[model samples]
Target chain A: MIPYAELLGLSVEPGETAPTYVMPFAVDVIGRPGFLHGGAIGGLLEMAAVGALKQALADEGAVRIKPINLTVDYMRGGRDKPTRARGTVTRLGTRVANVEAVAWQDEPDRPIAAARMNYLIVR
Target chain B: MSDSETPAGRAFDPRRLFGGRFGGHGGRLGIVYHDHGEDWAELALPYHPDLIGDPASGVLASGPILALMDMATSVGVWLKLDAFKGHATLDLRIDYLRPARPGRTVIGRGECYRITRSIAFVRGQAHDGDPNDPLAHVAGTFMAVEGYW
Candidate 1:
């Protein structure tokens, strides 16, 4: 688990390819009444993206990562329920990595939020 | 701040809305309502050790800043509409111009430029101290849960 991921109380679920991140519903993560904060959801997506990128580069040498920018789209208000997120690396170049992550509550098919992130990778 | 919710025609006082121990994420991070105007709102996030992303650098994480801007912009939408209506973030994009200065309060100011029937457009910037030198730039949209009447 990443440092920020642990702060958000996120845990990695066992998976073959890309690990899924689970964030349980709690006061520390809620936004308005009975809903999750957009920031928390965004953070979760980012952590998922980072997790995927790390896994993709696990075989390679150590690299430092920094975020360039992020765009988060909230499709639905996250209700009082555990949310799950997973990321996909669209492009992995020498200097940068483009990742996209989706977060869902009840069903994977129905995503509550999605985010696109660009990261600077330093070798 | 008054305990009552602002009347429909009056300006919204975010301080009152956020008064007392915040129960959720906003409370956990100690997000406070700073100031506002007819179409804009500002919120503050005080630096804390737990909010740091890189302890070595002592710079705050981007997640807390994102949350601050999210709430600030949401309030801006409400202030523009002149009424509290149910809405959700449609999309938000943040460009990290620079990391916020450690141990300094970061203030996020959000403005609502336009509002259609269902969509509100917002833009904002975050800065530690100097507004001219902003730490982050954000642009986003919010959609009403129910049709705007």
Candidate 2:
């Protein structure tokens, strides 16, 4: 299996309740001017959700989970600065898990994007 | 751009291409055939300030690029197959090599890599400079819809 960091191009860091992922916004990632592209943010959120699920399953002694569906809501435009993402496991059933994530810039109160993803565990 | 050029190549008037509403954004996001013939078709998008996410910072909106690429690839299939067969994108993946520089119009040239009865495979790149090392690369598959449009 590939290391989570290598697969997502970001690393999971310790947070208060759950872990946070840092995705640096490079100039190449920009969509229009100062705002990051929707596609790029979507990709980032997808990766973060998947990584969070992997970590959560590992804690429970599970091996693998495959992504089934993902839905992202663009709350506000993401600035060009490096952004941070946080993911939480809402529920981990026997064969499925529901996860939620939020991405923000400097302020945690205002999230640029939020997502809810469903994963199918491979037992 | 100018209001000239048709799909049939007779006087090439833009009004006649795709029933004169080709450039409007209501349906299919204003994709129109700039040039279409036996081998290839070209599509164009007008520059919009809203599409410009950063004025001081030079970059074209990524949504517009994706829309352009999606439409271009579909149009390529239509031209090659000689009909408007519907298709759904399976997975559209893009790698951003560089930011699209501001103040320049962007165009996508998509080619059908392979097409079967059920699927059409496509690979193309978006460029603002040197097409060899493009600013963006895209690879995707479109499942052919059964009904014709």
Candidate 3:
């Protein structure tokens, strides 16, 4: 696990193929008195995006992944609960990859936040 | 000294607000105040091994930087309004120009450019050392629960 992710108490749950990242609601991830910080959710989304990209690029050998940019939309206030996030690799090219991730607490259909990320592949 | 000399100082004191508590996530990240203006605020993130994203490169993760900018912009909104308005980040976009050098503190400066009745527009950049060469650029908006007025 990335040290920052570890510090945030983010863990991975194995899926059939890829993995879903989960962040526990804790003091380290809190922003306001009652709500989760925007950054923590953003971080979880980034981790999920990276995890999916890595899984997709597993056969490519030691290719390094670099983030180009990310846009995050906060749809709802994340309450005190374990938040889950998963990523979809929208496009994987020779030079770049696009990934999208969403975080939700109760229902996957209703997300608390969503992120679109682009990464540069260093081969 | 005078009224004009200290408008936000009277209401939204970032120093006193964040003071020793640091408040959860920011506290865990070891972020500290750097400076501020009437409509802008700067915060610094100290280097720590625990925050590294890429262990091979020892570079700090972008997550912490995003968090720093979020808080900085949040403070910028309060500074501009001269009070701490209840608001939440609606959306934020971050463009990574380059990775920060290992073992250096990162400085994020956020500015609130406009404030309407319900939204505050913000933009900022993060730099490890030279302000001219920024590591990331960010723009976003916050939705206020109460009218910003």
- What are the iRMS values of all candidates? 1.5, 13.2, 0.5
Clashing pairs in 2: A33-B53, A33-B54, B5-B12, B5-B14, B6-B12
lDDT string for model 2 (A46-109, tens) is 6567657767766667466655545556667777577788778899898989988888888988
Model 1: lDDT to the true structure: 0.87
Candidate order by lDDT, decreasing, is 3, 1, 2
- Deviation (Å) of A94 in candidate 2: 33
- Show where candidate 2 strays beyond 4 Å: A1-123, B1-31, B37-39, B129-133, B147-149
| Winning candidate number (DockQ) | 3
Return the top candidate by lDDT: 3
Q: Score the docking of each candidate (DockQ).
A: 0.65, 0.05, 0.93
RMSD of 2: 13.3
Task: Order the candidates by DockQ, highest first.
Answer: 3, 1, 2
State in Å the error of residue A27, model 1.
0.7
Cα error of candidate 3 at position B55, Å: 0.9
The RMSD of every model to the true structure, in order and in angstroms, is 3.0, 13.3, 2.6
TM-score for the A chain of candidate 2: 0.83
**What is candidate 3's lDDT per residue for B43-127, written digit by digit as tens?**
9998999999999899999999999999999999998888887899999999999998999999999999999999999999999
Best by TM-score: 3
DockQ of 1: 0.65
Q: Show model 1 residue runs off by greater than 4 Å.
A: A1-3, B1-9
lDDT of 2 at A86: 78
Rank the models by TM-score, top first: 3, 1, 2
